[model samples]
Target: MAGKAPYIVPVGPIHPALKEPVHIELTVVGEEVISADFTPGQTHRGIEWMGLSRNPVQIVHLTDRICGICGVTHSLAFARAVEQIADITVPERGDYVRTIIAEFERIQSHLLWAGVAAHELGFDTLFYLAWRVREEAMDAIEVITGNRVNYDIIQIGGTRRDITEDQYDKIRKCLNTYKDLFSKLKKLFLEDAVIKSRCVGTGLLSFETAMAYSAVGPTSRASGVTADLRVDYPYCAYGDLDIKPIMPTIYGSDVNGDTYDRIVVRIFEVAQSVEIIETCLDNMPPGPVIWEEKVAKILSTCKKASGEAVGRHEAPRGEAVHYVAMDGAEAPISWKVKASSYSNLHVWPIILKGAQLADIPVIVASVDPCLSCTDRVAVTDNGSTKIFTKEQLAKMSYEKSRRMMQ
Candidate 1:
């Protein structure tokens, strides 16, 4: 142990106690992590590559599989790319509907991540309460699109169906219900001393580092990096809506650019998304959801020219960019998807190095990383590897609480 290479520890693939299948390799000198190598390619399924050969009609569902939690973002990116390629314009009402659905996705996603973060940090009661409230959003998705996880309602030109007055009424009620609960939940998570002590100064990321590393979403915004697609670069009906892009420390302090800051950014955004959805609903206009006759005509119009298009959408995690190349056929020649998780996840080793092992889950959860998009693992350690069961970790946290009480 005198003059040896640092111990390299691999954190996942099928092994994270609180995350999906992404792998993290950390090089540690004694108890301090000196560097980290992130490998998120284990679960790569070439979904985007497959989109190249499938007809434009089939690519919609393929996009949905990229990230189950933010499937709508993927679909929207692909659909927008295709529309750009074919020069098909969506109706104003169609744009508003798309914005509503996307905002709904953001609200539920942030809530899910917040609950998971609470659970990871040993705050089980808060986790349960937050998730129970998030169910209202899930129900809304089900009522609107007949599915909760993967809506599959975004077609090539427009949505598969229009939002009914009944759906709008239900959503309004859900928002009101969420608003009250969110106020309570926000206070507990953002201002709780215990939560703040663990998260406030941990996982610090500077604004420059965030920009250099291409961080996005709450991860970037928490660090005071001005990068939000909805506000910085408007898309869809986002331009029509009033979005100030909530940053961290808005509750009463300046940004600490830490895990706590990231959590606060997300918590506040849940309310922001709710407000945007309400605006979209209030401004709703009547029109056909799908552009039926024009799609064929548009396809015919594109047959004479070969072109390509790119579409970018802000997902719950960050920016989702899609590249589509069309050869004037019914399908795209090639399609490439760069999920927000791809860039945001790379900042992990930088954030987790100095933190305690017990805090790893909370730090990882803070970014709301989407591991299904990038997954892989490798390990290097000289000592015996220790694996703890989920029950063991739960017991450890519980025992620690008991000791504190004693």
Candidate 2:
């Protein structure tokens, strides 16, 4: 028994357990993971190719579909890149609106992650608790942008809508509700026996390893890497505030970069987003929300412009960026999207090495893996495929998380 060999177990491609298809091969002895290799890009949508085929206006909408949760950041990054090339300055009001939407989206995303993480730990009550609290932010966003998931708000020059006095009141009320709930939720994640026992020592990623992998967003922050795109490269209304990256140390944790630390970092981030939203609403100036060009005019204008630029955003997962090149054509000559998961995914092998088999889902969900957003990539895979829908993936993720509780 002592001389028995480890076995290679495959965990994806057509696997129903993930939100998107990713094949993770594990070298394990008994139930303990010895090493791991991950292969992603299963849900490639050819978004970058799509961006090149359509006008910039169309790409704005297309980018929103990159990941339903992180769509606003996608639109924000693409719009900023196009604005840089076109030499356009967004209005003060537009910047404020963008900031508000961005923060609101962050709240929604972080809460969604929290719920998923909780579900992964087999704590469905907390999953429902986190999402129930998440609804306030969603409601606030729906009021501002008219849709919950993909706001369709950000444009090249500005946003599609602005906040009114009555709407601001509604948003403020929603914010108040979130603020009240965060304190309680924070205690639950940090102190609850079930969450702490399951997550605290699991999926450890060191600061050095995180830096080597170039991890972004809460993943890096939990490891004490203060590399937020908003702070390093200010865009949108992010320049309005002096941002500080939240770390697990802030919430009474050593910077272990474990699943619990990741949860703590997100909890702190939710509070930060609330503060940013308030500040943005307070200082917003009245002006045009977007450039006064119609859809047809936008395409014509794009066709006359030629340049190359990059735009980056602090997506909920990490740093989401887009590289854009225009060549005096209605459509882009070249466009590349780099979602946050692309960099963060590299840390998987390190974190999953010493984990147990049951910890696989917990560790993977710890990074908030968004394979769909990361899909429009250049890596080629000649592997076989499967037919798995988004709903099946969600169900699988939930079932796995619930099982982890056992």
Off by over 4 Å in 2: 14-17, 376-406
Local accuracy of candidate 1 as per-residue lDDT tens digits, 298-404? 55655543688889999998898988888877667777778888888878878987877667778878888887764422233786555665367558668988999
Q: How does each model score on lDDT?
A: 0.81, 0.86
Name the TM-score of candidate 2: 0.91
Query: In candidate 2, what are the lDDT values of residues 1-406, reduced to their tens digit?
Result: 3787999999987664576788899999988899999877678766765566688998899999989898898999999888888877888889889888988899999999888888878888998999998999999989999998888998888887878888989999998898888789888888999878888889999989998889989999898898888888787778879778888878765788899899998898999999999998888887788775476665566678899999888888888889999888888888888889989998999999989998888898899988888864343357655555546755866898899998
Best by TM-score: 2
* Deviation (Å) of 216 in candidate 1: 0.9
Candidate 1: pairs in clash: 40-374, 40-375, 42-375
lDDT, residue 52, candidate 1: 64
* Model 1 local distance difference test score: 0.81
Models 1 onward score TM values of 0.88, 0.91
**How big is the RMSD of model 2?**
7.5
Runs of candidate 1 with Cα error greater than 4 angstroms are: 1-6, 293-305, 375-406
